[model samples]
Every structure is written in structure tokens, then in C-alpha cells.
Target chain A: MIRSIRSQAQFYYGGLVVALVSLILVGFNYYERFGRLKTLDERLDEQLTIARPLMFRGPEERPPPRREERGEDLRRPEKRKPPPPDRFDPLPKLRKEIEVARFREGPQGEEVLASLIRDGFYVLGFKPNGEELFRSENAPDAVVPWVNKRDRAKKRDRDSFQRWSGDFREAIQFGQGRGYLLVGTDASRLHEGLNELMLKLSLVCFALTGVVLAIGWILMGKALRPIDQITKVAQSICEGDSNRRIDTDSIRNELGPLGRILNTTFDRLVRSVQQQIRITADASHELRTPVSVILADCDLALRKESSSERKQETIELCRDTALHMKSLIESLTQMARWDSSSDVLKKEKCDLGQIAEQTAKMFTPLAEEKNVEIIIETTPCETFCDPLAIKQTLANLISNAIHYNKPSGKVTIRTKRIGKSNIIEVEDTGFGISSQDLPKIFERFYRIDKAREIEEGHSGLGLSISKAIVEAHGGSIEAYSQKGIGSRFVIQLP
Target chain B: MKILIVEDNQRLRRSMLEYARAEGCVADAASDGEEGLYKALNWDYDLILLDVMMPKIDGWEMLRRIRERKTTPVIMVTARAQIDDRVRGLDEGADDYLVKPFEMRELMARIRANTRRVENNPQPCLEAGDIMVNTVKRLAYFKDQAVELTAREYNLLEMFMYKRNEVLSREFIYDHLFDERDETVSNMLEVYVYKLRSKFGKDSIQTRRGLGYVFMPES
Candidate 1:
């Protein structure tokens, strides 16, 4: 639906760039999030290691308890040793250790712990009695209860917690078989950083898409400029400016060849138009002359006080003019049929020799008027062709020979076969055509001797019509002539 | 007046010659441009009717060759009625142009106009002293009085008036006054001259012994 090529090209390129950029952005965001989660877990493990020593009583401070004493204490659960009167409780000891460690570490470690606490990270310690022994002031309210049960179920000396709350990465770890520690770190900043990077990348991608689309629109116009020019030229030609042509020299690449072909087509179109105009003009001229003669003769016949004899002569002249006009009209109609390419040849197997002989015989009387001899030689050549059209063509040539011949000139009609084709030749000892006029002899309305043609009542279309008929039958007619020697018309049919 | 018609169409040329003769002009016609050009160059004609399309040479070429030597007034008669053809004909020294299928009356009028132009006489009247012959009306007058004459007598008088004071031979009179189709005796021209003299006055025609007759009007 988008009519402008520029917009279409921009949309395609921009869509592809945006799609690829979005895919890459999504991939990078996922990888970054994964790395952030792993790093948070490792940081939680280190914090638990630092807190483990503080939570457990020193191993050397108490003798190893007897196995029977541990078993009997567990069997008499509540009434057994209410912890020897001198036994030290580890809850207060773990709290004091956490405070000492938090205070004794170097300034960098203390700063790291303080910042972690400020950013909503906290640590907790749980005792073997299934109770929370210590909890940091910033610890989440759910940490003690959750860590007490998790620590009692723990079977290892060191473990890590994995939990998420809002924007924090929380973990529970137990170290040295003493107690469980809970650690939570704020991961919202890392997520926020990744989100910000994605936003910036998206914005860059959009800007890049816009820039690329704009450049593409302009470049496409530049590339298609030659097509626009060719279209404009064609439009002008359609509007009747037949002389208009595209400037092919300025075009290069693919459009260059296209422009040249279009120019050639235009040239042919113009030539045909000019030729049609000429034919119409010549036809009207030829048609009008006979009418003029007839009209004049009639007018003269109707003159007052004219003798009957004069009137009779004028009437005879009118009748002759009318007949000439009829013949000229028929010739013109034939030419028109040929021009329209509507005359299909009626093909039949017929002998070229018989046609030539018959046509020559028909012209014998006329030839004898000028004392010209008619000669026919045939080799029984048989061919597939339109017999009527072939006979007409031969008749036209023979008539032309008789008309142009001097007294006692010879006309020879010969037919023979050569290879796969039949050849018919009509040679005349008449006044041969000049070399200059020989080439144009077959053109419509072309006459080497217009006066002779008029005197003989020839319409000058005989040769042209003959050529068209021969060509329609898959044949060619050619004439070879010398200025004064003689002319030969040759027909080849396949 | 003597006129030449050079048309390629045989019937058209023949009809034009007939019309020229009927109008009392000695007209010679050629069937093609080549013959037309040949006659036009070799002879003096008061007017020439040339067709544009012809055999060896065309009217345009013929006119060009004719203009190179002679200043004979030419009227182009052709079937091409395009304005370009008319302009070309006139530009090539034609005195007038008549398109084919034109009214015979129009051609005759053009012939008259062109011949008048050549003679420097606007009226279609020939004059020798006090005798005036109205060519269009086919009438003659002597001292303002209409003179009754036959067509042949009038033609003979007009020919004499056209070349007054010049001796015209018997053969010349016969050639001008009669059509080629007409068969006339050698002394037929003498009868026309005798009739013209009796009607106009004996002094108007002078006998030149064995040469011919001359129209020498008395001062």
C-alpha cells in the first residue's frame, strides 16, 4: 500500500536492523543477569567463612565428650546434664565474636561490611538447639525462623543460602558444624545497571535505524533516478512527442541497456508513423487525379452548343477515366490489405512453371503490341504455395516488363529447382532500371518513370504488392538491374 | 494565347487540353513531367499547366528547370492540396496552384489569370488599335459596336490581335484554331481570315503576299 519506493525501502531495512539489535540486547541481558547471580552467591560464601569462627566454641577449650554421656543425655532428654555448671553457652560467645570481627578487620573490610549492611544485606547465626543464636540488626524478619529449621537439617560443615526477596540475593550457610549463618545482598543495583545498559543500547539501535533508513531512502532515489527519467520520456512520447528520447549516455549499469532498447523502439515507432502519413498522402493524390479527369470530362460534355461528336468524345474520356479510377482504387485496397498484414496466403501445391507460363501467355498480346517476344522455360519445378498469389506476382512482373520494354525486346520467364527451394526468374530485355532507382523499385508508389507509368495506366503499386504476396508465401523477390542492359526479377520459395 | 498542359494522367491531360481549346487557347499537352519539361524549355508558351507528380521529373523539378531559363507564367495543377504543396509550388516560381478534383471553371480562370499576368493585361480582352476582342465573352467590337463572328473567326481574330503587326502563317492559324481531333482542309484558315476581315473591315487584315496574313491596324 505504500506507494513511495523510498518509504518501502526504509521500512524493510529499518525493520531488519531493529529485529537483530533487539535479539542481541535480549541475549546480553540474560548473560549479565546470570553472572550477577553467580557473583552474589560467591560473595555470600566468603561472608559466611568470616563469620564461621565466631559462631562455634573453640575445640581445645572442652574435653571430648564421652560417647555414652552424649547417648544417655539424648535418652534422658530434659533431665540429663543441664549443661555442666561451668559449661560455656555459645550464643553470647557467637555474638561477641561477630562484634569483634566486625570491629577488628582492616578499614577496607570494615567499610565493605558497613556498606553491605547499609545496602540491606544481613547475617544470622542459628544454634544446634534449633534456635536463632544471633541476628544482625539489618537482617530480614523471616531469616531467624527460616535459618533455624534449615540449620538443623544441614548435614555439612559449610553450605550456602539461595533465596530472593524483592531486590536481594539471600543465602543460609553453616560452618565448622557450629551454626548456620544467613546472608543477603542487594542485587537491585546490578539489575538496574543491566536495565540501564539495555535502555541505552535500545536507544542507540533506534537512532542507528533512523540514520540508516534516511540514508537508504536517499540512496535508493539516487539509484532509481534513471528509471524515473525513462518513465518521463515514455510519458512524453505517449502524449505525442514522438521525438523525445531518454539520454542514455548519462545512465550506467542495468538501466543503460534498458534505455537504449526503449530508444530503438521509439525510433521505429516514429518511422512507421511517418511512413503511414506518406502512404495516405500518396493514396489520396493518386485517387483524386482520376476523379478530376472524370469530372472535367463530364463538365466539358455538358457544355452548351457543343457538337454531338465532341460530347461523345468527352463521354468516352469520362468512361476511360472511370475505369482507370476503379483500377487505381483496387490497387490501393490491395496495398491496404498488405499494410495491415491481414492477407493470409492460401497455400496449395502447384507448379511454378505452369503459373509462369500462364501469366506470360496472358501478357503475350500486350507484348506483341510492342513486338516484344515472350519466352518460357520450365524444369517441372513443383512447390507449395498460394497459386493465385504466385500467378498474380508473376503477372505483375511480366506486365511491368512489357510496359517498360522497347519494340522487339525479349521477356523470358524461367522456373527451376535449386536444393530445397524453387526459383522463378523473369528476365527482360526492356529498358532496365538505373542502379539508383533499382533499390527503391519495390517501395509503394515508387516509380522510376512516372510518365511512362501514367501513360500505361500503371498504379506503381504492382511491384510492391507482388513483393508482399511473395513474402507472405514464405518467399523473397529480388531484382538485379543495369542502367541500360536489362533487369532480372528472381523469386525464391521454400 | 498558347498554353501548355503537362499532366501525368492521360485522361486528365486530354480533358485539360480539350478545356483549353474550348476556351479558344492554343494548348499543347504532355502526358508526363519529362515531356512537359522538354516542351516547356524548348518553346515559348503564354502559360503552362504543370502537374506535381510525373514520370522522369516531377512538376517541382520541371518548374525549377523552366525558371532557370524562361519566365513563362506557370499554373500548377495537382492532386496534392496540402498547404505545404501549395506553398512549395508558389515558392518554386509557379504563378498559381489548382488542386485536383477542382472545378474545370476554376482551372480555366487560373489559366486566364496567369496568361493575363504574363501579358500585363488584367482584362480578358485582346486589342489591336480600335478592335477589341473580349475573350471571356467570345465577342468582338469595333468602335464600341459588337461585331458578329463565328467561334473560329473570333479565335482567328484573337490570335491576330495577340500578335498584331506580325505575320502569322496559314499553318499557324490552323494549328491554333483547330483541335488535333478535327480534320480540316489546308484552305480552312483562309475562310476564317476572310470572314474576320469582312466583319471588322478590310484594312484591319493585311495580306503578306506568299508569307501569311498580318493584322496591321491603320493609324
Candidate 2:
């Protein structure tokens, strides 16, 4: 639910760390406690078993010791003694009972049994006459409610086991009609050790979770520092310093594919903004002259002393200026459309060769008047493009070639397919663009020969429009020129 | 007064030159800043109308080059209408800044204001002795009577009135009064002096032998 990745990761991962640590700690505590207690219980069982045979002073001289079979053992005092041998072993085994007992071998077994009794382990026995036969020093004779496990052997009493209802895990058993013996070990220290371990582990889990979250926060901050820097750069760009950029070099784990993406995006945005500013200023400047012309024409026409011929020329000039404005507006609109989207391409399968031929035919008269030879060498250049747009671009290039050509210059329009692309080239033996002006010719409203160009009423949008249209078709246009030698324009359509 | 128009756009230049001529001023135009700077350096134009953007050299460089030698009133006409651009133009020694798509009337008014400032006469009306001239309407009055005058005669008279006490040389008058396209006559000053002498008095413009002519009209 956290909005931030760092916070969310810290919350969930910290919870997982806590849960895993607690589970491992509890499992380990219980495992060690169970192992130690099992060893203690088995030792107690063995000792009690070993000492059981020493309990009966007289094996069977007396009648069966059934007096204390029910609940009479608790009335006797505690006992610790070796039991008699199994004189009644051949007696019906169904009347016999067995319980756990253990003592180690050699003289060390006696010391172990003594230590076991000292460590809250006990052995007690009852006499046949219902008195306290023998008791370990630490044995007690408190009344007890036993939980018994009945033996499942063929001799029903052979493996009889019983323990107290309390946590001491004590047990007692007896042979047939004889007083039962007791053997039990105190295991409270195991529970105490486990509880202490749980406490320490809980503290460790809490501290570890906190440390993990803090480290996660620090590392996450390091990972996300670029966002702050990028945001700062974006803000400054909005504040009019478009040249400022996000420093992508020192950044990692950026929002996009990399920091380079955001930097490139900002670069593109700044470029577009600058282009837009230039276009606006240039368009206004371009429109100003025509407007001035129209206004002056109107002023001249309105003068009362103006001759009829002068008025006639004024009207013509105004009309021409109006037409120029119209064309300028059309070019501006076309550029705007392309800027928004090249969706206006409306591409269709066509041949660039045929388009060039048709465009050359349209310009044949002008070329002839200028004494320029028009040559069209075309192959079947199959391509997908908007035919009208392609023809217009060709017309523009051809017209420029003718307009700037020498008196006897030759203009050639060639269209052919090269590789997987369709190529259309217009080469001319004309006054080519200077090197400095070549790169700027495709910019809107840029003219090389200002005086001659202005008089011709060329809006300087021809090459710009041609480029726009060509690029809209997913094509590229390039110009190569030498100052006085020639100029060539190439269009590559994919 | 003679004026120079330096504009990249041919239509605007020609049209404005015609309008200036119509307003009774001899005007010439250049197509770019390179040509404009050449003409500006060689000629003593009363005013220079400059376009900011040009093919060879831009207006700022022209202004900078011009400011090093001449102080001819320059009015920068450009489409860059930003306040910073205007301030920069003025800071670069331009006399005025006019944004394009401006009304012809506004442009003419600004031209007149700048030219008058150069002439040390901010007001449109100039009165010397008994002769009063309204430079805006190109009208002159003598002793409470309107004196009908041709554009050239009026221009000559206005020049003399503006520089009333100073003796202007023949070359100075000729160069300042005529545009390059004007058909100059060697005796044109004599003809004009004779014409003005009959209207005003002989004492109005007294010849100083080898020096020049100075107007000394009395009230």
C-alpha cells in the first residue's frame, strides 16, 4: 500500500525477516530442549529399570502385594533401593509390570545415579505390607494423579509406563500384585532454557529487522537520488534555461531505459522549443513584407492624384502580394501539420520515375525558355508514397534547378531503385548553394541570394516544404552543391 | 531630407522608398547589410532605416560598424519584438526600434521623430525669423501667408531654415538634397536660390562668396 518503493520493500521484507528469524529461533530452541530432555528421560528410565530388581527384599514368601495396587503408593514415603530378583518371572507374565530404569556400567554408574538423584531425579518403592520400603534422599510422597500408558505386549503389564500429570514427566510401575516403584526426572530447566532463548531471539529479530529497514532506506535513497536531480533540471529548463540538462553520466537505475533516455528527451524538447521560436519569428518576418506591400499598394491606390495606370499597377501588386501571403500561409500550415504528425502522408504504392516524368513535363516550358536542357533518365522506381506530395517535391527541386541554372545548363532528373530503397535525384548544372548556405537551405524561410530571391517572390519555403513532405513519407532528403559548379538533391524513400 | 532604407525584403524596401519619395524626401535602398553598410559609410544620409536580419551582414554588425564612424540616426525595423531585443538595439547605438507589421503611419512618424531629434528640433514646427515651416505637412508660411512651394524647393528651404545661421557648402547641399537616382543639374542651386529670393527677400539667403549661402530672414 505504500506509494514509495523503498517504504514498501522495507515494510514487507522486514516482516519476512522477522517471521523467518522467529521461526528458526523457536525451532532451534525447541530442538535443543527436546534432545537434552530426551537424553535425561532415557537415562532415568534405564536407572529405574536397573534398580527395579533390587526393590523386593523377599521375592514371593508373602502373598501377592496387591494391597497398594490402586492408589496406596502415594500414602507411603519416598524410597530408593535395589529391588529383589524376579522370582516370579515364570509366574503368569500377565500379572507383571515394567517401567523404565537406567544406570551406567562400572563404578561410575553409581556416581551417575547419585548425581541424577541429586539433580531432582527420584526413585521410590512400596512394601508388600503397605509401608515405605526404601526411598531416594530427594524423593517425596505427595499424592499424585498419574497418566498411564498401558503396555501393548502379549504380557499386558510388561511395558506399563506412567508419568505424573504435571510437567515433571515422572513415571512409576510395579510387578504383579507387588508395590509399584517410581522413577522421574525434573525437566523444568529445559523449559527455562528454551524460554530464555526465545527472549533473546525475539530481541535479535527486532534489532535485525530495524537494521535491515535502515539499510534498505539508505540504499534505496542512493538508488533514487537521480530522480531528484532530474526533477531539478526539468524545473530549471522550465525557468527559461533550455540549455540546462540532466547530468546522465553519474546516474543509474533511471526512470526510463537509462538516464540517457531522459537526457535525450530533454534535448529533443529543447531543440523543438528553439525551432518553434525561430519558426514563429521567421514567419512573422516573412509575412511582414507582403503585408507592407499590400498596405502600400492600398495607400497608392487610394490617392486622388494617382493616375489610372498607377492605380492599375497598385491593384496588380496588391493581388500578387495577396497570392504570396496565401502561399506562405499554405506552406506554414503544411509545416504545422507535419510537425504535429506525418499522418498526412496518405501513402500509396507508386513509381517515383513516373512522378518525375510528370513533374518534368510540367516544367518543360520554363526550362526551354531558360535554354536549359531537361533530361529524365528514369527506371521503374517502385515505392510507397503520397503521389501528389512526391510530385510537388520533385517539382520544387526541378524548378530550383532551372531557376538557378546557367543559360545552357543541363538539368537531369533521375529515379531508380537502389538496394531496398527508392532513390530520386535531381542534379543541375546551376549556380549551386555555397557551403555555408547549404545546411541552412532546408530551414524555413532561408534564402541564399537574398536580393534575387526576394525579387522573384520566392518565399524560401520550397526546399523546406519539399523536405517536410519527403520526410513525412519516412524518407530523407539531402543536398550537395558546389558554389558555381552544380547542385544535386537526393531523396531516399524506404 | 535624404534617407537610406536597408532591408532584405525587396518589396518592403521598394514600397517604403516610394512612400518616402511621396512624402517629399529623396530616398535610396540597399538589399542587405553589406551593401547598406557600404552606402552608409560613404554617404551622409539624414536617417537610415535598418532591418535586423539580412543575408550577408546583420543589422547589429552594421550598426556596430556604422557607430564607429557615423552617428546617422538609425531606426531598427525588425520582427524581433522582444523587449530585450529592443533594449539591445538601443544599447547598440540605434536611434529607434520599430517592430515589423507596424503601421506605415507609425513608421513614418517614428522616422520623423528621429530625424527631428537629429536636426535638434523635436517639434514638427520650425520658425526662423518670419518664416515658419511645418515639416510634417511640408508646408511653409511667410508673414501669415501660406507659401506654395514644390517638394524640392520646400526641401531646400527647410534645410536652410534648419541650418539657418550656418553657411552650407554647395557640395553639402547637393549631396544632402539629391538621391543617387536624381538627375543633378550643375546650376540647380542657383535656380532654387533665385526662386526662393523672389518669394522671400534677397536678405533671406545671402551668399558668402566662396563660402556658401546662409539664410538671414528677419521677423
Candidate 3:
């Protein structure tokens, strides 16, 4: 959801910027075209002003007299039909007998008239066709013919029009000429059409920018597609589907870091869950056996005529089982406490060898019942470990050994100082382990094929619990065995 | 001695009754707290075998009531072997606490030990016909002459004195007399009864044929 929102915002703002720039470009083009047209109109006006003398002959020929003067009835041009395409030529419209400046302003009238006619300006000379140029009755009435003597030299001042006209005529003889009366043409219309074209081009450019922005937004969304999938997978994982994995193989980027972190966390959680299941199942199974035995024994004793001896036997059985249950509960509670506070073991030091001896003596009868010799060979040794935990570990290992040993077998327990370490070994002549079962022997409830062992229902927790205790004591335990031979367990304490 | 067992579990109650009868006590049983309390409050018994768990009134309450009325010795019989439970049961007016599924022999021993304290009522002469037993010296006086008896015989005589009128079964005789290894299948109780009768006269100890032997004391 977040990814889509970000992508949409990118699209909207990106499109807006492109359209704005295009609009500005269009406005700029319109401005440039408008400026060009205005300059062209001004040049046309100046040319008309230069040729005024040829047409009206004096400054009194100003149109409308600036204020309250009779206006010249300059007739509008007749609407001429557009030429056919086949006969059309690339030339501007013009009128015949348009005014042109002559010796009144310059002496080189012939050259000036030739240049004017060639350049699309009709330069009708005054002497040749002046009357024809002014034949219209509506032309400004003050247009008088130029004087050739003192009447022409009305003012001697340099800034006066008489002196200026004399200078203009001299300059014209030296190849400088004035203007012409430009007639009816479509130049203004052409300027307006060019402006329209510029405006349209600018609009197209704006439209192109819009299309580019749209495509950019879509491409960006496409490029970030994998990110969206990754985000969805992340959300699912956070929602407790720890097994949900990001499967995008595009692992060359930041997503790889996220995927790896999630996978690592899930793996740890899975392992802990598996351990928890095994622990609960093992505990329940262990509890069920004793409870079933007590219940069955009580049931039997209850239903029949149990003699004093038989009644006593059943009661004793119940007592023993109840004690076993109590001990098991106590051990579990202790283990739980230890699990929560393992650092408490660091507070004390005790002798593990003596504890091992005491543990071995506890099962002396069980060993003797099988004609087995339990030999406790040890050097005096002490270590900084939980005495209770060490005793429990030793008892568990020795019990397992006794339970699995053969008749007339020798069970040897040896503790020694091996180069600054306390080493304990419990070896028994028993039906040993197969190589295949070695790896998982210390796993909870992992009994080695119970049918093959002589003991009935040997709880597989002995080794597992021993391993836990040893590890908690900063120690390591290992087992070595071969089928048909004896098994040996060795523990090293630091 | 008439004993009352107040156990909730039918099986445990029956077994315990059987155990008490084997120890030569005239045992009566109630299956719940209310029945136990009713029996315990009204009846005169040497010992009350109370189980902890029961309907209505439990062993602790029954024991408390029994102590309040008669001060009769009450022994708690329970499967809850927790030390704290035992301590609590004892603290609640039980004379002793025995964890159940106990050995029949151990139960008999505990019952005897608990009843001994209540039997301190001064009886200068404990007599049965020509046999006049001295309670203080633990002596058997017979035919105007003292007859020396072993510790086992003395205990047997004491049991007979407690239930002088009621017949004691042979199964009841052997349990209190012998240990676990004694072959109870033999006619051991008959042998002991014959010996006692011969020494003290057969008329004093009446044989009920198939039922058992009864000590008929002279009124």
C-alpha cells in the first residue's frame, strides 16, 4: 500500500512539472512572435512616413491634422479573390503608382526609382507621374508642388525642413535614398499567422512533455515492482507467518539484507519451537508411565482379596511411584529455574569426584544384582560447578550404565585430573550403540531401539539431561561405543 | 479394638479395612467425609483411619471433630505423600499420618503405636477366667500362678483383651504377629491359638470352628 502511494505521488508531481515547463515554453514562443510582428509594423510605418512628401508634397499633408481636421477619404481596397493554386506566385500584394521620394529630397532620382521598383516598392517619380500619384480627390489637399528658387528657400536655419531637404537631396546623389508608399499588402496577416503557428508548436511541445512524464511514472512503477512484492512478504512475516519467505531472486540489492535477516530469525524460532515440543512430550511421557503403574497396581489391589503382604506390596509400590513422581516434578522445577537463571552456578565451588562416588554407591545393589562390579577409580578432584547438577549428571549416567550393562559385566567409573581439567568416565560392558544412532543420542526422547535393550522402558532422557547439565557446568560430554562391545561416556569439566 | 476407616476411594478403603482386620481390629468403614464424621462423632472406636480426600466432610475435618468429641486416636491414610500434607494432617488433630499404599505390616505397626497411647486407662488387673494379667508388669497370672509369656504372646493377649467378646479371624492373627516373610498361607494363627489355649485353658479361648477364635472373658 505504501509503495503504490509513493509511486502515485511521483507520477502526479512529475506530470505537473513537465506540463508547467511546456506552458512556459509556449508563452515564450508567443512573446517572441508578438515582438517580431510589432517591429515589422513599425518599419512599414517609417517607410510610409518617408514617402509622404512625394504623395502630399509637404508637412501640411499630415493625415487628420492631429486634431479637428477634415479626414482624407482613402478608399478601402476592393476584395480581390484569391489566385488559383496553379497560377499562384510567391509575391506580396501591391498597388500601382505608389509614391516615391525624388530630387525634392535627393538628386539621384533615376537610380532611386530603379531600386525602388525592383524591391517590390512602386517608386513613381514626381516629374513623370506626380499628378497620377495624387489624382485622387480625397488625398490631403495641402500637398503642393516643390518650389525651385527663393520660394523653396524659406528658412536658412539648419534644422529647418528647407535646409534638411537640400541635405537629403545631396545625400541621395551619393547613393542614399528615402522610402516609398507601401500599398495594400498582407504582411500583418502573415505576421499574425506566424504567431499562431508558434503558439500551436508550443502547445504540442507541452503535450509531448506530458506524454513523457506519464511514461516516466509508469516505468518507475514497473522498476519498483519487486519492492512491492518484498513489502507484502514483509508484512505477512510481521503478522506471524514467520515461514513466509521472500522468493525474489533479485538478491543483488537491499532486499537481500532484509530477506537474510528474516530467514535467520525464523530459523531460530523454528529450532526453539521444536525443542519446546520435544521437552513437553518427553516430560509427559515420563509422567504417564509412573502414573499408569500406580493406577494399575491400586486397581488390582482394590478389586481382589489382597493378603496383608499383597496389600502391603501394592501400597509400597504406590509409595515408590509417588515418590518418583515427586522427584521428577522437583527436577523439572529445578531445570526450569536453572534455565531462567544459569548464572547462579558461578557462585560456588565443589568436589565432583566425591559426588560421583556417592551417586555410584546409590545403585550398588542394582549393579550387584547382575553380578556386575562397579569400580569407582578416581583421584581427588574439585571444580567450580553446581554440586547438585553434577550429582544429577553422574547419577543419570551411572544409572544408564547399570541399566544397560550385561550380567557379570564390570562397570568402571573413573575420575582423573587431565591437564588442568576434571575428567569423568563411566564405562560399562553393555550392548553398545550403532554408529548411525550416535549423532542423535543426546536428543530428548531419542531412545536407542528399546527392544534391543534388556531393560524395559528405559527413558531416553538420561543422556540428554546429562548433556544439558554438563553443558550448564561449562563442561562437555561425549560417548563412544561399538555394537556387541561396551559403551563409554566421558565428561570434561573446566 | 473397633476401628473406623474414613477413606473415599472404595478400593483403598476396603484394602485398609482388610489391613486393619488382619491386624486383629474390628474395623468398620465409611466411604465419605459425612459418613466418616457421623461414625466418628457417635461411635466409640480405638482408632479412626481417615483419608484426606472425601465427599462432604474430609479427613481433616472428621479428625478435628473426632478429636473434639472423644479424643480418639485418628490416623490419616492418604495417597498424597507430600510432607507438607502429612504435617498438615497431623496438625489438624490426627494422631499420626501414614502415606497410603503403605505396607500392611507398617499400617498395623502404626495403628498399634497410635492405639497404645490411648489405652493408658488404668486397669490394675486384666483377667480372663483363671488367667489374671497384670497390665503394669506385662505379666500373665494363670491358675493363681504367674505364667511367663514372650513379647509376641503378650501382644497377642493384649489384642485379645481389647476385643474379648468378638471372634478374631486367623488372617487377623498372623498379620500383627509375623513380618512380611512369614508364610501366611500356613495355619500359623491356629498353631498360636492352640498354644495359648493349652497354657491358659481351652475354655478361656473359645474356638468358633470355621470363623475364628474368640476370647470369652468371665463377667
Best by TM-score: 2
Candidate DockQ values, in order, are 0.49, 0.38, 0.02
**Sort by lDDT, top down from the best:** 2, 1, 3
CAPRI docking class of candidate 3 = incorrect
lDDT of 3 at A335: 50
Model 3 Cα lDDT, one tens digit per residue, A1-494: 43575567765777678767877876777787667656544543443445445443454533322111324343655454444543353231122123223333455444434443343333222332223332222222333334335533552221112112221111110001121132211244545677688768767876777687678778666666667777887788668776787665766566577767866766666656665665565566556545644654565566456567776888987786677667666655555444443575653677777878888898898888877889999777877887877887888888778777788888889998888899999999988888988888987557665322212434555566678778877789999998778899999999
Best by lDDT: 2
List candidate 3 segments past 4 Å from native.
A1-6, A30-34, A37-211, A214-219, A228-244, A294-441, A446-459, A468-476, A481-487, A491-494, B1-219
TM-score of the second chain for every model: 0.82, 0.96, 0.59
What TM-score does candidate 1 get on C-alpha atoms? 0.65
For DockQ, the strongest prediction is 1
lDDT of 1 at A283: 75
> What lDDT score goes with residue A32 in model 3?
74
Q: In candidate 1, what are the lDDT values of residues B1-219, reduced to their tens digit?
A: 678888877777777787778777778888777888888887667788988877678888999999999998898888889999999899889989888898888888777777666656677887767888887778999988999886678767777876788897776666657644567788787787778778888888888888888988755
Per-candidate clashes come to 4, 27, 5
Model 2 bad stretches (over 4 Å): A1-3, A27-190, A197-271, A295-318, A332-350, A364-389, A404-452, A464-494, B6-8, B22-44, B51-72, B76-94, B97-99, B122-157, B168-213, B217-219
RMSD of each: 8.9, 9.1, 20.4
Worst 10 residues of 2 chain A by lDDT: A94-103
Cα-based TM-score, every candidate: 0.65, 0.67, 0.39
